[model samples]
Target: MTINCLDLFAGSGGFTLGLKEAGIKTKAAIEIDRFAVETFRHNFPKVDMHHRDITSFNDKEIKSNFTGVDLIVGGPPCQGFSVAGPSQYGKLDDRNNLVLEYLRFVKVISPNMVIMENVKNFINGKLPSKDKVIDVVTNILDKLGYDIKIEVLYAPKFGVPQSRTRVFVIAIKRGCGLPFPEIHETHGPDKKNYITVGEAITDLPFISSSAGYDDSPDKLTYNEIELSTYQKMMRKDGKGIYNHISMKHTPRLIERFKHIPLGGSLLDVPLEHGQRARNGTDLDTKARFKMNNQRLDPSKISHCVTASFQSTFVHPVMNRNLTAREGARLQSFPDKFIFKGPRTLMSKSLLIRENREHEIGLSQYNQIGNSVPPLLAKAIGSAIVKSFKHKVNDTRRATHEFA
Candidate 1:
């Protein structure tokens, strides 16, 4: 009755951790990012990790390596399908095609259940082959004899502090008589009130932008601040905090943060310190984006934590941005989940220009930002586990009647 999983495109093992929490075992994981692989390895040392491009694996190699996997779970890279990206690229962005690679693995592994997660826009996004991405994926799953269910889940409803919405495609093999699993909301107006940003992270010790270390021997212990129920849960297994280092910011940027209020963004900053035009001139436009250097409101849930969140979000009370540890907390990563690799990486253009693209990998911030919130993943995993139990019970009843 144990459920075994194969994680494809597993970024920092978020999905795997959630499945583990739900009593499912992840037998193996595949990831292309080296830093992500490092973080995954550090946390899940026992899980087999294939640190290579998923596309490079031939069908024979996949079948030979991964057999008897009861479930397959992953979040194919979503930059191309994300609405946050350039609209002109649309389906043409090469990353969008990775979904096909994900499907290829599923075909080879022949798992009983498959769960794929992506940005909410992915549900309607089109593939480069002029087909709706969802349609193409579901069509293949149908032909492969699997019933599919698609839904856009709001993270906060599942106990994550951030308002992240993602599309989940759940496929169950035909004849299981198992419908899509129903994951009930644990946090909302009707249930418990959504966890606030403060509740998620206030227990951690505060550090300034100029303070803290990437990998110090010194582990920070809990301060005297009262811990919230969520914080208590995060620290349940953690002895001390690591990877809580803050990013160094320029004095000018620090000054700008002073003018911004909680829940404010770029629009809140004065023209003198506002976002500059490409040519370094001040633009008089009042355009504002919720993601631009957003100062979180401690009383409410946070805005979406994107991969570039190190620079996108300002700390609620501090003038500097959130540390990798703080971002992890908002994503519902427990305090014990230590992130590995550089605290922050150079921009892609800068790295490419410097010819160091291969030398450097995803930063800790990038790994945390790109991860699925563990709590939300746990909800999905629990639902699937429930379905498996139901199937077992039904089989038992049938066998008893026949006897």
Candidate 2:
């Protein structure tokens, strides 16, 4: 029997992509953003998409959508729980409380297994200590008689090119007693090397920031490559890769990139160029150096890929920041998974363009930044499916003995 899943806060279906890869069928997904909904449909046309606010989601409606889901996978919105975003007290209306909505569904649907992902700050943040979150979550699951396991996983360790750290909680129905998912150590003394930025993007051709050329809407073009290994692997299939959103750079941003050396930051540029450098620590400054290239430190891996263009995500080799496609590649989204919607349509577009004056899809870029790497999602999906199957097996054995 096919393992089925109900995905919550399913942004662009990154979690769904992984679940599908791990052999679980996504029966339905709930998301609020119209852009994310469009992107999800571009990839998963058949998934039952509920574009309603997660807070308004109905448990009975969800339960009626599927008979018995083997797994539930999702992340509640993380702004309130995120240390990076504005840290509001856990208010009743705070988006962070959507975790309760997730719990409500768990109570109603009672899936055999549940998998959750969120920013690492969810565990380390001060407002809601990790313990508090776990206690509440575990209590709910415990009431339903399930054993839970939680961990903070780093994505690069799982073959994703970028360094993304997230808190993951996995639970299996008790009495079945399934073990937690094994960590796939792909890098270091124990295994092969962790995925690298160079390994992820060596295939695309180079495009200068000033160039006003556009490829056919169907066939996308890659602008840079450091090596052929990553490039060749990404292009293994002829269908061409997806999620290739490149932004146009302003004259000043382009000049700043030109002056900044490889692995150097905006601070590295001379003061003559109207920029300043940090004295000791990384404060929010345009003058700070951006670590654009992926360095080969076997002990430490790459930095987390974020959606903000102004952040320190510049190309290691190129003069400007890493484009949306480059960021997506680092996150291990397949080549065919294209993103929709223009970047400048969001509320923050004016501020972004005023500061940088770039004509790229800023909102869509942020979505990609906020998304869970689909490859990592697949790993979580696989683990959840395995745990669910183990529970079903135990159930069958108990029934047979009674018979």
Candidate 3:
């Protein structure tokens, strides 16, 4: 039997896209953002969609549409729980409260399984009372009669071009004994060599941060690397890339990009610029946050790419900010996914986001700052399918014995 999925907080349908690739069917999706909703609907024309706030939704409404979904999958808004934000796990973060809404849906639909993805920091610390994330998450699942298994997964380990680390929780019902996904491979056969920024974007065509073209639906090509495995897999249909949003950088930011090295950071730049060149907090000395740690090396992979531009997100080679296409590419978004809204939406988002210090009223850039890269989502989806298949086999055996 085909596994059915109900995707909540489905941003650009990244989780949905990966689940579909893993052979699960998305019966319905609930998303709150207008841009995300339009984009999800455009790509997934066949799936039913709910475009309203999840808080207002009721269990009876969901039951009316989906009776017994096999899986409930989503990455709820993480701004509240994210380290990038205030890092407040439980209090004052309204977004954090929404997780219970997800749990509520699970209580109503009682899906056979649940899959959730979030930032790695979620595992690094506790909620309140110093409780582990698993403790909190499992408590919710336990009430729903599901057994949860979790792992902090790195994307580069699973064939994604970028090095994105995220926490994934996979929960199966009590009777279903599903094993966790084993780490199959690491980047470059050694612990030292990780998926580099160069490997991820080297093949794409060069567009300066200052350039913009009228919206065109025709698929386009950038460079010789278009046929590479990553590109080919992303463009599964063999059509050219489409809807790759590119933004140019200002002249001043362009000058700053010239100072960053392939793996160097803002510290390498001059002290007069008022940029903090120090490493992260001097507490952990290793290069944990170095991936995109405020450098503009187009030759290197970006740190966690955000939808917001306030971070030191200039291009490594160009003087301008990273274009929307570059940001999307770093996030593992497929080229064909189109974003609606005016061009100024991109500009205003970056401007308002770059300066804001507080957690509230984040620009669109900050809103997308810590999204689960879609490429990583696909790998997690693969693992979920693997676990699900194993459970299906076990259930078959038990059924046969009873018969």
Candidate 4:
């Protein structure tokens, strides 16, 4: 009665890790990013990793290989439907069509269950063809005899120390009589309080912006401090601290950080210190994004970590930006889950100017920010596992009675 899964668009195996934690076996994964694929292969060496685009495979090829998969999980590129994407394009962005590619695989695989994750805006997004994305997906699942349930899950409520929210579409095949999985919130007012940023990362050793390197053997050993419950869980199987290196900020940038208080953003900085311009021209005007360079309030959950998180979150107490490991901790990634690839990447403009777009790949920060929190995924996966076990037990009892 083991459940086998095929993970599509599996960036760095976040979903795979959660499924594994929930006692589900991820038989295979497909990812297009070379660095992410390498990370996935490194972490999940036994899984069949396909390092190519999902659209490259025809329906016949998918069916021939993934015919018996019990579950299919994916979070297709959300840039097109994300609120962070360019608003001018809105639903007309070409990347929004990737959902169709996701559906294509689902149609061919016809797994017992399907789970799709995306940014919160995905619930209201529409394709270029003037059809709502959710409506289109639901119609297809309905035609395929699936019972669909969609929910927007909040990360903090699920024990993640980040205030991120995403939409999940869960579909179970008809005739199984298995109701939708019940994913209960474990960290809220009625339950345990939400894990705080301090609880999630305060245990890691401190390092200056100039300390640590990418993929270097140099690692800061953990201190013998009293560990929090969240810290104990994170360090359960971790060998040592890795990817805890901070970004080297300019002296001026460090000075700017001095003006911002805890939970304060760039708006707190004086205009003389190169604050962001308002209306693209009024540099003297006090206007800044709440997400940009905001010092973390250690007492509460963190703001959403986006793919550009390399420059998004300032450290809670330090006058530097968060290291890749700190962001990973906020996202509920265990300490043992080593992120592979460059620590950071050049800006998109620089890459384009230097004609290095072809060499583009996900950096450690990008991979961390792009991932679903493993703890949240585990909660959802646990519910699915519970329902599956229940179905299996009922089937066994019925067979015994018949015989």
Candidate 5:
């Protein structure tokens, strides 16, 4: 039996890939950004795609492409609730409204199962108004007649090389008797079990942070052997070396990078110009890192790779921010899964985000950073499939009784 799925708010098919890994076929996907939509089409050439505001996406048209969608899965952008982000839209930003849009489709499609993902803070987080986001979500999903199970899944616990934590809400139709996915602990709580940043990207070619974008989607091997089990898994069934381009940084930035040691911080680097200060000179006048941590420890799992990692995270060894390719490896995306869109913009400032009216469009870096780690997704998918097997057995026994 084929399990059909629709990826709502599908940003370059991250959740879709997870479903595919779980033996599900993605029937269609909807994304708002022009760049994300283009990348999704490039990767999943045969899959149907809709590009535009999903609120305006008509169900009548969707019905023509697919019938009886078994699952609808997506992670509505949660920047407003993201602990790493501003965290208080105080009022619904256009992005936050996508949560309602997600529920809208769930009500329409009424899939046997629905999976929604968001930042870890989403559970207790509030929208800009009186109603809590969680309360609104649970109430609406309950009204739609689905039983819900919510969990805050940590990425590394399920084989991702990073320590990203996100909330997943799984809704199985009433009386389905399906439990939430069985959690797996692949790597955690021990030095040997954890995947380090070096282990994840060691097999890829070393590129300078100050390099320009490369258009070719050809694989470039690092001339080194794939040593880690994690590396082997990502490289498995992969043929292309795509989206490895580095940000084109300036001479001063390059000089700053050189000064930082392995796992050193951009914040700690001495500045070229500013009001002189004792700690590396003119620290206050310089660009603030605003990083959760100033440096990445090469020997350990990485900090979350946000869209702004270009300026925020220092390479464990290289004198640059992690390349898009390196970040993908850390995110457990196979080498074949190349990111498409502008590699790096002239500026990645916070201005556009502050303007509540505008959405922060995804860049290649953003696409990879914002994705669910494919390994973690695979684990979840595998568990879901396991539950479905039980569901199938239950149906068979019930049918036999009826007969």
Candidate 6:
């Protein structure tokens, strides 16, 4: 029997991609964003796609359209619940209701397993009513005959090169006992498996700061055609890697990047801001560094690859920031998995640093940054599959325990 699934708020299909890798095929995906939907269709062509907002999407259609969904894999739009976006006391709106929509489908479909991913803080995040979202979800899942299990997994520890932390809430049918997903740890603090930024991108061609979109293959700087096991797996059947380009940085931003050292944070820039702020040639400015921004540390695991990472993370050796593809690589997306949309996913936030500009939706960077690393997804998917065929013993014991 095939384990069918549905991906909700399927941003660029990252969760779905990993679920597919682990034998769970998506019956259909619902995404409102045009750019993300295009990328999803381009990659997973056969599956049904819906561009309607989930809130307004007729709930009855879910049952009428599909059945026997062993799993429902996806999270509601998290911008409202995210600690980075807004405080619980503020910004309450319809977006928060999307999670309720997710539950509505769950109530109807009653999938055997439901896996939801969200920002780590979502576990305890609250709505304006002062009701904890996690508590509400736990209550709902319990009443729905699901045994709830929650774990916050860090990407770096689970084969991803970057240090992004996400919360995975797994609920299995009540008869299954606790649903513990097996973890495939590729890197860790003690284990050398933690992939470094350099190891992740060393093989890709060096891109200049002014680099634009290119549809050709990147020139390899290193010899020996044999790729690292990580590279070989990620490069499988990849053709002209699309969306591997750089976002145009302002001249002032370039000057800012010059003063920041590798792996430093925003607090790393030079202190001399007023005098000769625009000039890079000033001796005082050149020497007066006070920690400007975060550049990738090639030797160590990368920090979180966020939509604004390019604005902050400078290349370890190179003077420029990571291109879209390099950012994708850091997120552990294979080369074959192409990202299609505007070359840059610019939003109102960019206006803070850039001129007035606009786009239909997310760029490759946002898609990648916002995605659950496929490696992490694959691990979770594989574990879920295993629970069906074997005892729940496949569970990886807690490495770094968090309540």
Error of 1 at 56 (Å): 1.0
Question: Counting only residues 3 or more apart in sequence or on different chains, how many pairs clash (N, Cα, C under 3 Å) in candidate 6?
Answer: 12
Whole-model lDDT for model 1 versus the true structure?
Answer: 0.87
For 136-240, candidate 6 gives per-residue lDDT tens digits of 888999999888888888888778888788888888887654446666665656747788887787777666677645465553232235577777777788874
Kindly list the per-residue Cα lDDT of model 3 for residues 286-381, writing each as its tens digit.
322343336544444456564554444655554555555556556666666554433334344455678643322323343344456666666666
Work out the TM-score per prediction.
Answer: 0.96, 0.81, 0.80, 0.95, 0.88, 0.85
| Candidate 4 least-lDDT 10 residues | 278-287
How far in Å is the alpha carbon of 361 misplaced in model 1?
Answer: 2.0
- Winner on lDDT between 2 and 3 is 2
User: 5 or 6, which is superior by TM-score?
Assistant: 5
Candidate 3 local lDDT, residue 156: 63
| Tens-digit lDDT string for candidate 4 (23-133) | 999998999998899889989999999999898999788987776799999898888788778534543787778898998888888888999999998887878786889
In candidate 4, the residue pairs with backbone N, CA or C atoms under 3 Å apart (3 or more residues apart, or in different chains) clash, namely none
Candidate 5 overall Cα lDDT vs. reference? 0.75
- What is the alpha-carbon RMSD of candidate 6 to the true structure? 6.7
lDDT of model 1, residue 35: 92
For each candidate, what is the lDDT?
Answer: 0.87, 0.66, 0.63, 0.86, 0.75, 0.75
In candidate 2, which residue ranges exceed 4 Å CA deviation? 88-93, 126-131, 176-179, 188-192, 210-233, 236-238, 241-245, 274-301, 309-311, 344-362, 389-403
> How does candidate 2 score on lDDT?
0.66
Deviation from native of the Cα of residue 268 in model 5, angstroms: 2.8
TM-score of 4: 0.95
Model 1 regions lying over 4 Å from their true place:
88-91, 189-192, 217-219, 278-280, 287-290
Cα displacement (angstroms), candidate 3, residue 114, comes to 0.8
Task: Rate residue 146 of model 3 by lDDT.
Answer: 87
lDDT of 2 by residue, 83-181 (tens): 557654434225656787888888788877788788876764432333456567778888987787878887876777766788988777765556666
